[model samples]
Target: MYELKIALRQILSRKKQTLFAILAVALAVAVITVMMAMLSGFQDELVRSSIENNPHIVISPQDEGEEFIHLYRYTSALIAKKEGVIAVSPKYLGQAALEYRDNAEGVSLQGVNPESEENVMRVNKDVIEGDLLTLVHTKYGILLGDRLAENLEVHIGDLSLIHISEPTRLRRISY
Candidate 1:
């Protein structure tokens, strides 16, 4: 009771100071609450984008020295039939040189089944122009990034002849 009376007396004596202190605390709480909300929203967006932009699982070649997975179709079918498995997309990734006219530029190449890739990668969102899903119906259709299109001086619907480079192979048996 005495301590409470003393605290009340001190607070009453410094009315402006007490009011300002209360206001300062409230303002601090408000600022902190807003910051926390913003941070939470930012974190949620980051997680969502990370999930959307990347595949949850990737199947790599068993042997690092091997350039290709020989039985990918068989493996993909088996994996797809597994329980709780959502999407299984087979992607062929390589480095190639594309040539148009007299200009040639080395580029990373990716060949994927548009239908299955759509289910796994959600690749349609990344396309700035043209339809990625349309490739399912269009046979021999290819998608090109802006940088690659610019490098090759090609436009949409323009039939630009491109040359792909074959990787040089050198095999030697260990004695």
Candidate 2:
């Protein structure tokens, strides 16, 4: 065709421009491909790390004053039966004040089934001292973090009294 011949002649005449144009297109494609791959990798890494470190979802009560979650056992059992459900842990969260003579520290407390919590959180991995598993056999036992223990001026095996304030009542936790 006459048009094709003319186009070929033009491309041949502008050899440097044609080559530069091709290189530019190839470079653009390469950059876009690399960027897409990097973004995908970052997304995967973020998802994996987040899932490993924390729970994917948490089901809680609609009422703020509701300390107890009803049907939690059934809910946990049902969730466990689902596909790809790793672990289920029911937790009772409370804010309490710990008093040891003149030294008093307000702390957030968590009551959990140790075995299930361990399966979900693997909390024992972070322990610098003491056994997190001992909670299984511990009755009214308290596991204090090193920093919190230092702040409260307490040590291992030290007995202390903690005061927990509930939504409608104030209660004392004896340890």
C-alpha RMSD by candidate, in order: 8.1, 7.1
- Model 2, position 105, has a per-residue lDDT of 87
Model 1 per-residue lDDT tens digits across residues 61-92: 99999877889999999999999999999999
- Global lDDT of each candidate: 0.77, 0.78
What TM-score does candidate 1 reach?
0.71
| Candidate number of the best lDDT | 2
Worst 10 residues of 2 by lDDT: 166-175
Over 59-133, each residue of candidate 2 has an lDDT whose tens digit, in order, gives 888798786779999988999999999889998888887765578888888888878988998887877767767
Candidate 1: RMSD to truth? 8.1
TM-score per prediction, in order, is 0.71, 0.64
Q: What is the number of residue pairs that collide in model 2?
A: 0
lDDT of 2 at 49: 78
Best by TM-score: 1
